[model samples]
Target: MAELSADAAWNYVYCQGWNRDLQRFVGLLDSDTACARNEAGEQYSVTLLRGGVPRVVIDIAWSAHYLGVWTLDEALRRDSHVDYRRLRAEQLFPVRERVWRYAEGQRDGDDDVWEQEVSRKANGWMSTSKRPRGRLGGSSRTAGQEDDTDIWREVPVFGDWRWALPDKEAGPVGTAAEHTGEYEAVSAGSPWRPPTPYRNLYLDDLMLEGATVLMEGAQPRVVAHRLRGMVDMPTGQVITCEPRWLDYSEPFTDTIEPGRYEVHDVLLTDPDSESDWWPRAGFLLRVSEAPVVSWEMALRAGEDPRTLSDGDFYGFSGSQGCFVDAEPLRTADHQINADRGREQSYALRKWARMAKRGELHEHPHSQWSDALERGLDDRDGIRLPGTNFNMIAYNCYYPDGSYPTWIGRATDGAIVCFLTDMRTTHPVIATDH
Candidate 1:
């Protein structure tokens, strides 16, 4: 129950889904506002966000040690003591286009072609922007705003960015595990009654099912949603609830390094189907790709379509696009699904003002030496970025990579990250913590 400094107030950011988790969390911090700094040497406010969003940035007088380094991989870490409630600005920040991500190859029996399904928007051939706008760096200014998806300004853009889901698995009928610890085994016999009626979002398929690994060399670990569960507040007969889960059995894009094997595969019993008895006929889920993180394997050249449950879990192609454009946004026509082709890469170009170019701090972020020696560019050779109340902008030269950074400290001296800038921009407070 902390408060913001008089100079700052909690600014509102957009919510990802229509879930009540955000609204209730807002009530917790009176809007758990945050403050963090960017390379602009200015302080801004931000609403912390979760998932593949921006790292919460606060308005700090000081920048981090890697402020002038050219490569990424040096700026990865967890948050510490900073007044997250008292934010640095309102929105979140986008990547500098240095850090990048993409879909890896599909495995045997991966029915869903994640890459092909999500490629239309990756190349910039078409779009759905009414104003022909590109990307929305979460924190925006009117006149300063233009249709520039490829442009990197250290600002938070809230548009379309997705944590590529898992590839479906081909398997036998998956069984459902009871919501085990949810309620202590009540009755000794059959009809076990409940204590206090608390509504649990225990989807029949999501109740921790068994897994079967299809890939011969793949890891057989049965990993799926890490921290799983929902929060429910009873409302008389019915209960209101919000869902949250640490689905850590994420798929990797196969950046198979030395000895470390990439983790993939999730045991999910897909719900719903044309069948009446098993209305959700596809009860079992043993996709070729492991969990989401495991699919974070090294981006390959031909990681197109893999079949799992005969359905499609979309994916994006073209390297480094995640840091800038929302690719393959949608190919088919809203009215005519058949006419749709691909989501063209909405461009986001970056060019410094005449004066700013000469003094470009090419190697602005240099904290991690190993990356420095390797000579990696901030997504697109960006140095200094733009800033505002809740964001910073990284002007991107290439639409591929992302320039990741260390978010700053808010007032009152406490640290907590509300935004996570993996690709798209803007910071909404993360409801988990």
Candidate 2:
């Protein structure tokens, strides 16, 4: 390909559907990846691809509604060896025809790339391929020796640990053992007591040494959910862990960190509704950036049916009365006007900062904090498109201490995303819920 000419340097702006304020605002909203997420109940089911590393699982309370999203909140990457890069491919189907550029140290180059277009029709499958030219065909990797799934993480100041996420812990905050069922109720009047401003709430980044987890055993029936950090407030330390599930009721709740912990549970919920529709990870995660925070986890199978997707973070387990959302759940009251008073971009940042400031020490209402417009937890929410576990959710809180919620919605309406195959609509009944 020869270099282009200056005459062909066509440059101009083209506007197609543009007219009034409604359309303009709608357009703005469309570009918002944030909105695509947290659209509660628009779709149900999140699937981690067959190659999803580490583990996959999430849990949202079935009774929650209004605003809930499959949130991929809070991620940070520190400089390290084994130079790595993350590519966010925006496409209708990146398996073949993609929407954007090939990221990550160039998954490929100008060199020939193999193109296999597969389709399903009736009881048969179809595949059209554009084989690579000469040596550009298959990679040098051998059978079963494909991609390397290794990661590293470093702690961040004010950042809490998150096990579920592939990142390191940031701060020292973890839930207490046993379901107190009183995180929200306790000191809802004025229960804030943050660390002193002089405290070393450094915004420094610690380097994460790369490590490996060798599973040397008969691979047990695996069930992995994202992890939340554990912090012993008494000692001001943070730790990240990946806890395994034993049974339904008494799953292992090991504290990687010692000492007593005060439960400051951060959930992915709507800002204004009674409760979120999804099963939030009960006890996990750390505070980040003083203002924002994140919560991670999924899955809780029920005995009624074993219909759980890979990384089913919010589904219930055991033989109890299990319920699934029949249709895409929807909810209002994600972030109220009061929450977004006018200044804050996200509500979580304000809430976290205030919490650290001891604002809620006496009463939640007294320490009530609100933001102008933003989420309670400010972290990049993870999302997997086209796959079954393609979920997106986020939330914000009202300083006035109302039942916090999120601005959430799902793209896969009633679709069940899981391993094995692609998306399959798994409609759940709201009545049972």
Candidate 3:
């Protein structure tokens, strides 16, 4: 059993399209190789059986291309004995092309037929000498530097854990033999007692180590969502301009970090309105040079939260948890208006220091957290793209103890909302005065 280090640079693959049902990337096909190798081309699907039952079946071709598996040996010079460079070079589809093919494949509901088509294309290319090359061409140098800036923005802090593990005993937060749902419920005790700061909360479950299933025969759903606030390359725009999904239900709820919220659980507009729309959350940047602090160590050090950096620490009140905003608890204009009050500001300031205090907590709610934002519901909430899960956005409490309203989509994964008071409604639904 080899452990891919927590900092492994290339653990993700860019797929054809986002899978609405599975909440993962639908791997783009390598039709060229499928045609060239015949039975050997089936190297993409490597099935491992347990007691003759297919316990694990991973797509090796997809893994090699997406996770930079081919470059690992040449660049890192570590996994030298094995090579997947050939398969990586054979990936011919770009994001748009892949999206269309995957969409058609799903719409027709014919996986085998699509596979055959891909194989046929590859075979035809051999005779015509017209093989398609992906946006990242054939050179190993170009392949190594494939357009990952967008990929990184889409997923900054990825780990091996599933969004929600099926087994209650081996859950993300605990491994008790007979588990109690303490983490799931709002605590009856003081909300200030946050969950213990963890180091790689997803690493405990060994199954999360690879794109494949764990040794225990558990095939969990992959927990893959783009980080919010990513800058879209072509548009030269930050991704926050678009709305995303937020789910606060059972399966998704199980995945939430104790003091954090995911994009799927939030909504920007009221779903029941006649004209349904989703809007992206707003962000305000207030830069500070204060040293970062971690929550676990800060608690032990007995340091004042007010003295810590903005947007650094986390605190809990009963079952609710929130990270302090980088800015003081002021309205968007940065005014210390008495109307917004003081306790919330103090709370926000205290939580902001957790990052520098030596706690192994995620620095969410900031642009620096990841190439894209995932765990940020604080800086006007992070915007996650292409999610299918939904949540009722009637009104949920912000970590600052304020209840904000959200709007949701019925079919797709888009949500929009306003954090503070605002009068402008959705333009599509707004009646002419």
Assess every candidate by TM-score.
0.18, 0.16, 0.17
**Backbone clashes per model, in order?**
150, 113, 39
Candidate 2 segments whose C-alpha is farther than 4 A from its true place: 1-239, 245-259, 271-433
* Candidate number achieving the greatest lDDT relative to the actual structure: 3
Number of the candidate with higher TM-score, 1 or 3: 1
User: Candidate 2, 2: how far from true, in Å?
Assistant: 16
Candidate 1, lDDT over the whole model: 0.20
Best by TM-score: 1
Model 2, range 1-433, lDDT digits (tens) per residue? 1111223211111111111112111111121222233233121211111111102112211212111111121111111101111111111111111111222443322344333332211112223333334236663221222222222222111112142233342222232111111111121211111111110111110001121111113211111223222222222222111111111121111111223222222222323457534232122232221322221122122211112112222222221111111111111111122344455566567667777988744332232122201212323221111122111122212112112111111232221111110001112111211
lDDT of each: 0.20, 0.21, 0.22
Provide the RMSD of all predictions against the true structure, rounded to 1 decimal.
27.8, 30.1, 26.7
Give the RMSD in angstroms, all C-alphas superposed, for model 1: 27.8
Instruction: Sort the predicted structures by lDDT, highest score first.
Output: 3, 2, 1
Model 2, position 49, has a per-residue lDDT of 11
C-alpha positional error of residue 29 in candidate 1 after TM-score superposition, expressed in Å: 12
